[model samples]
Target: MKLESYVKLTFLSLSLFLLIACTSEEASKNKTEEPTKQSQTEKKKENQTSLKENIPNAPTNTDELIQYPGGKNAGKSIGILPEDEKKQVHKDLDEFPKITEDASETEKELYWNNLLYLFQEDYIDPQTVLEKWKMESFGSPDIEDPRFQFKENLNVEILLDASGSMNGKIGGKTKMELAKDSITEFSSSLPEGANVALRVYGHKGSGSDQDKQLSCESSEVVYAMENYEENNFEEALNKFNPSGWTPITLALNEAKEDMAEYNGDQNTNIIFLVSDGINTCGGDPVAVAKSLADSNIKPIVTVIGFDVDAKGQEQLRNVADASAGIYANVNDQKGLSEQFKSAQDIAEKWDRWKRDSLSDLDAIKVDRNFMILAFSNDWGRKRDKQNSNLISASDYLYYEKKMITKEMYNYLSDKRDEQKYLTDRSQEEVVSYLESINDKTYGEMKKSIEEKYKQK
Candidate 1:
């Protein structure tokens, strides 16, 4: 019985030892397999991250990939593909022939054309390539003394359209409201001695066939020709609301009469006609504008078509052309305000000119420097945008869509870098040219800069 018990104990110990050895072997196998699996996963993630690192702020989706941050398409998408078309595009890209250095010119052209076709939405127009380098004309620089001076008193008359369409909304505010605010700001900021007048048209009757005659004849000077008075000007603006048919002809005719006393010889007359539509009343505005231009008033009529339709713009442009003036079409409140700001700048320059009869050489130099800085900044922004867009597009094509081979993507990237280098050199050259002419006389500087950049 002792021998049998010892034998049973030995058998039990051997069985336990075998069980422990099997468990240890299983744990070791799991540990070895687990590291191999984890390594594969980490390697895959590292490869993806490295690919994405090619583009700064790399887009994860096609929508973000095609959106442009600047250029003429600002605030808008560069390209948007429908689902079916996108699938077809992916297939085409997958089968696209690779570009090679030893390829014939025609083959190379075809390959590049196909690639560029995919990104045609981001194509920059050659005509507008150097548009930011274009200089703005401040005043007549050819004169012996380039000063914004007027020998006579200045008269600024505003013919504001109170037609029903002025009630239209832009950016949550009525066109009339925006015009009133801008006009108020403009008049208040004018030179102290300048005479200002406010006239309202189509403010008397409702915009109905029954009241068309009254509306057509409704043109009156709400504020007489005098220096700006805040309370009086605000009261005059409050007296009118958007109403009645547009009687542009009658308004222009009445404006001639209003400024009949302020002839061009004694007063530098400037008439700003703000309208949203063409003349609804049957009258000849172009003829009237010509008459006003020919009269002793000799007013420079600047017709501002505030959100005017194409047809209305044409007629308004004709009126301005007849008067030997300018036409400005404003789409929003901001654009309208910018137009007014231009006039305000003129007023300020006029005041300065009156105070100082001679040219402000220091002011001219500062203005030139500011223009140069603006040009440089604009060029840099465009360059960076172009480079970022190209890199993002390449990454999207190569990794996300698997459309292009690695070699092709690398070639494209190298070409993009080269183009960026060229543009950088061009920007530096242009900025250097502008700096070189910083101290030149106004006429000489204007001529040199315009001649150089206009051709570009």
Candidate 2:
């Protein structure tokens, strides 16, 4: 649950895209035969086109059938992790920041690997340093049981902004419509036994009577954390008839209380917060975020901004970062659907870290000896929240532990996505970004972590 280094590698993905798009070399090559897919630009353009069309492919329309009965049914996982993966494995948390004087050479490697791995840079080649670390590495969640791989279960909580603003179009479709479709896809991807929940705000129908009006502050518990029907998530989306302003802070607190009903650790809970405006029911979101952090619930709260102003996006950003989660600006259904795609590697690693940290026999004891790993999106604090739904979830998993199914394989990603926007390293941007940090010996960054993470 501690904050480590920022994984501040200068990602040149955008520059890389530009470089490929406007490659000086292209002019000399061919004014010729429709460039083949071999050309990166041609390929990327095609992919982007496909991505745009598929964005609305999820359950955006009310008439579309939700393929999965409930959120827990199986489907082909959408995102696939890259084959290369790098991890910092450690014996335990106590080994962080190795105090050299207190440890010998052999122990330092394990602790260093674990500390750095806690916040490993996605761009680094995990396979490159095998010899340096002299340890075997596991890239991602191995598909052991296709039907029931040993991934840590995530109790998903979806917080939808059913405000009028959401009714607006982003990427050519209503944001609310997009969210519901994406949720349907997201839920279908989960392993059958995974727990889930849904909380929709501003869903009360509007009417002249004050009591009848569904305000932005209105939050409905459409589902608790458990296996659900496909219609369950869609029904909530259908209610997003646009009647109010956003109440993000109130929504989170409501979710926190609802999640408290579960008996499991907060680590199992995941919150997807979708919004489109500044708090109409204004309250201090920062304070609420700090509360979640303090509770050790380590919930991964991903905030999606839809067709909103810069200020609205910033507010959501702060809440997400403070809560140990991710902030994504998704204007259309496609962007929203891909939120999981962007964080796929982290999700897989999270499951693996949990599996590796504790043997199946140990789920009962809540072993203090094992420390948890976290990603920028997978903040460590949200994992501490107590949940009531996980009791049956754990039992269901224990009893139905089947081999991973095709459905499960699609879910596990071993590493970061290959095309995820890392600027293709324009030397200028990389150098400039590196220099601004006072390029003061990175050795300091290295030294601080070693000393702090070292074990007794």
Candidate number achieving the greatest TM-score relative to the actual structure: 1
Give one digit per residue, the lDDT tens place, for model 2 in 245-306. 56677888888887665423423556788887767666787678767755645555677766
**Which parts of model 1 have CA positions greater than 4 angstroms off?**
1-149, 361-456
**How many clashes show up per model?**
0, 60
Query: Tens digit of lDDT per residue, candidate 1, span 1-456?
Result: 999999999999999999999999999999999998997666444333312122223222222222211221121112343445345445645555433333443433344434433332221221122211111233335333212225457788999999998987655578899999989988999879988999999997889999999999999999999999999999999898998999999999989999998867666677999998899998899999999878988776778888775467679978987886666666556657766665666666667667876445566567657767765675576567556655655676778776456766776777666656666676677678768876665557556755765421
lDDT of candidate 2 vs native? Answer: 0.45
Using lDDT as the measure, the top candidate is: 1
**How does each model score on TM-score?**
0.54, 0.45
> How many angstroms is residue 201 displaced in model 1 relative to the true structure, after the best TM-score fit?
0.7
In angstroms, the error of model 1 at 367 is 4.3
Q: Supply candidate 2's per-residue lDDT for 172.
A: 44
